[model samples]
Target: MKTQIRLLLLSLTTSVFFITTSCRTELNEEIGAPQEQTLTANSKIADLILKTAMNDGSGDNILDGSSCFDISLPVTVVVNGTELTLNTEDDFEEIEAIFDQSSDDMDTLEFIFPITLIASDFSETIVENQDQLDALIEACEEDQEEDDDDIECIDFQYPLSVSVFNENSEVLETITFTNDEELHDFIKDLDEDDIVNISFPITVILSDNTEITINNLDELEEAIEEAIDDCDENDLGEERFIDVITSELLEVQKYKDNQSNETNNYRDYIFDFSEDGTVLVTLEDNDGDDTNNVTTEGTWSVRTRVDGGLNTTLDFGTEAPLNKLNNSWNVKKIQEKRIMLDEREGEGISKDELFFQQI
Candidate 1:
């Protein structure tokens, strides 16, 4: 009876030990395994990542005239007989403003070369003279027959992390990219069968400085598609407004004074903006029987304000009611049929409004 009891107890102890050991081994395996989520090959999300990571040359298209490449600064360029050393991107606005000052003269830009040119893949080439630059530009033009594929309106806010997984769902390596160049190269070199996962939530910045959070690949693709057409990617600059304003005869649609809290309806006035810096204003007197009209002359110009905003200055020499619109009005909106403007007093927008519509 003692031998039987001892044998039974030994068997129970052995069974319990094996059960605990097997449970521990399974738990360890589960804990060591990698997450199974991965990005699909040639997916829309992958395409978006590639497109957004591509170099955006449109921002400096004013200097190079090629959407395929950008002229790296601190490059010196002569703008309308004024030599300007553009040290940064903000300086490009000054060039546009200078070009906007006059529409009659043929706007000229002369580059003082030995400048660096950055390509769509973020590669750089040093050009010694205009000949070399022209050759590169010609090549870019040939290579890019279609519209540029870079999505300029939206960009990933880095640094973003991505993990590469192998066939067994084991992590091969992980990388953190700090800029577009790194991210672009990684995507460009990816193999079709490579399993990759991006660590979210990532942030994307829109053209208007709006920030969006992306939790997954679907959300990222949707965001890119939605914001792809949100802004003017052509880099038309101030010239866009100049062309619209000069091409038509406009009439005062709405004018209001914030200081006096008064509104004026100059519906009977017709304003013509000539390309030669002259403005013709014709006023019609509304009577019960017949219409009498008076025409006046004014000088007009578009210039860059100290704060880099475009302003349209009007000087209708001592003319009643028309002279009230004489301030250097800041451009608020420029539409096909309407131009909106305002004047600010000191800190906040004074709300003194002026609007012109096509007649």
Candidate 2:
């Protein structure tokens, strides 16, 4: 009986000790301190996010009632005493993931520190779980779902190659087109005077039920050059485009607000043409009062307006045109003044319209 009692007491004591140790570990593992970047596997850009909140100022405390809608500026952050740098682009995903998994709560305002800190920290995690950290960073750095704006596009205003062939597919003429005075002078000497390809039309189907079209390449080019010159007269050439419709002016709200009532304002857009005859475009501007202060930004599907023969019209995806009547679009490139839209069309349209130069 004595032996059995001693054995029972020993077992109970061991169980109690194990439980105590486990509890102590759980308590120590609590995350109370700021995370260090060197120990992380991802690259994060650090930007300072300021919000108007009602929190006590530790100089690091966020303001009262601030949310993600607040203006956020891109910034770089250094961590581990400036030994590491982080870029928001790289670590945005990973940090977001960590927040999702670890914290049941989130702050309305967040800060992105810097990129330099991330670079330094990445080098520190080179050994041991460096591979793991790298994998984590890559996973976190997974490219965010990009909108149409993230699509690849180009802007070209130059000459291109065009080949003319008879029904027999025999090459008749191969020529290049350019707005350059020298090139135009050369084309003027052509004997046949038959142009297989022409400039891409500048077409705008506006919101107020109006359509503005510019089909003449020479006229369109002249208008753009003239507008640019006019802005240059006031030394605003570097600042303003020849024609600006709905445009966005950052760090300059009052001026932007005056230009258009649309919340997203800014006439400048990106235009890209692929060698395979794909035209891509994206516009950046807010078009309303934006009372909530969330700067509106989005992109538009590139429309294929005109084909090479001047009479052919190609339609891109079906999206109602939101452009205003006064909006101006321009063709930036033409290969022998030819626009390429498909393969069956020989040598594709050479001259590519690069962008909609809003007037």
Candidate 3:
């Protein structure tokens, strides 16, 4: 009986050991295995990723005159007889001001060549002369009749994070991109089975400088599609009007306050905008006479907004009636002898209108 009991105890002990070892092995396998996730081939999110990562050519379109590529900066250019070293994107406005100096004269821009051209894929080509630059522009124009696929009106605010997962849904790595170039290359070289999940709550800036938060892939794709063509991407319209504002001797023809439902025929005030950022304001006597005119000096400037839109700002230093017009006004319409400007009150709910006609 003693031998049988000892044998039974040994058998129980062996069985417990085997059971514990088996359970541990199974648990280890489960913990070590990778999880599975799917990123569909040619998916909408994938396409959006590619588009967002594409090079933005419109930012430097003023320099290259092409929407397909950007001219690398620190280039010298002669703008209407004025030599300017354009080291940054902000210097483009100086060129525009030069072009606006004279509406009647032919605006000229001559680049000091041997400048670098950057393509949509971040490839670089050295353009030695005007001929080479022209060739590139011609090729780009022929290739794309409409605007390029790059969505310039909206930009992804960077330092974006993404996770790469394997077939078993195990995260293999996490990548962070600080710029479009890095993000573009990574997405372009993605493998067929690689699953990339973007860390969400990314911010996108619209052409109006409005920020939108995207929580998932669907929202990002939708935002890009909606804002792709929402802005004046070419800035051609703005360039044409800049000349009109600076050249004409303008008088306030009408003013309307939307909030108070008031209208004023401001035919008494004449404005002359000088290229040197000064304005001569002449206030005519309200009694339908030019005899008792009061002349005053004010400052005027055409400023480029963050979205690339232009705002004409006027400051008269607390002068009555003119002080009321001291806000940054958006150009609404530009005609041969008349320009219309409006000031909006919060998301354009209400507005004050100001019309200027050449005197």
The best candidate by lDDT is 1
For model 2, residues 92-177, the per-residue Cα lDDT tens digits are 33333342352223222222321111110111212123344334333322321111111011112445333332323423455564
Q: What is the lDDT of residue 56 in candidate 2?
A: 12
lDDT of 3 by residue, 94-119 (tens): 88777667644656678987899888
Each model's lDDT: 0.76, 0.27, 0.72
Error of 1 at 41 (Å): 6.1
Model 1 agreement with the true structure over 1-359: per-residue lDDT tens digits: 99999999999999999998997566434433343335756776777888889997766766765556778889999989999999998888888888879755767788997899888789899999988887777666555434557787898998999867554544367789999999989888887656787888999999779899998777888899999888645432245456667888998877888756333547778889987778998877777333467889998876544333467788888867887888878777666677888887775445698888887
lDDT, candidate 2, residue 220?
Answer: 37
| TM-score rank order | 1, 3, 2
Comparing candidate 1 with candidate 3, which one achieves the higher TM-score? 1
Q: Rank all candidate structures by their lDDT, best first, as comma-separated numbers.
A: 1, 3, 2
Error of 2 at 262 (Å): 31
Candidate 2 residue runs with Cα over 4 Å from true position? 1-196, 204-212, 230-359
Sequence-dependent TM-score of model 3: 0.56
TM-score of every prediction relative to native: 0.59, 0.15, 0.56
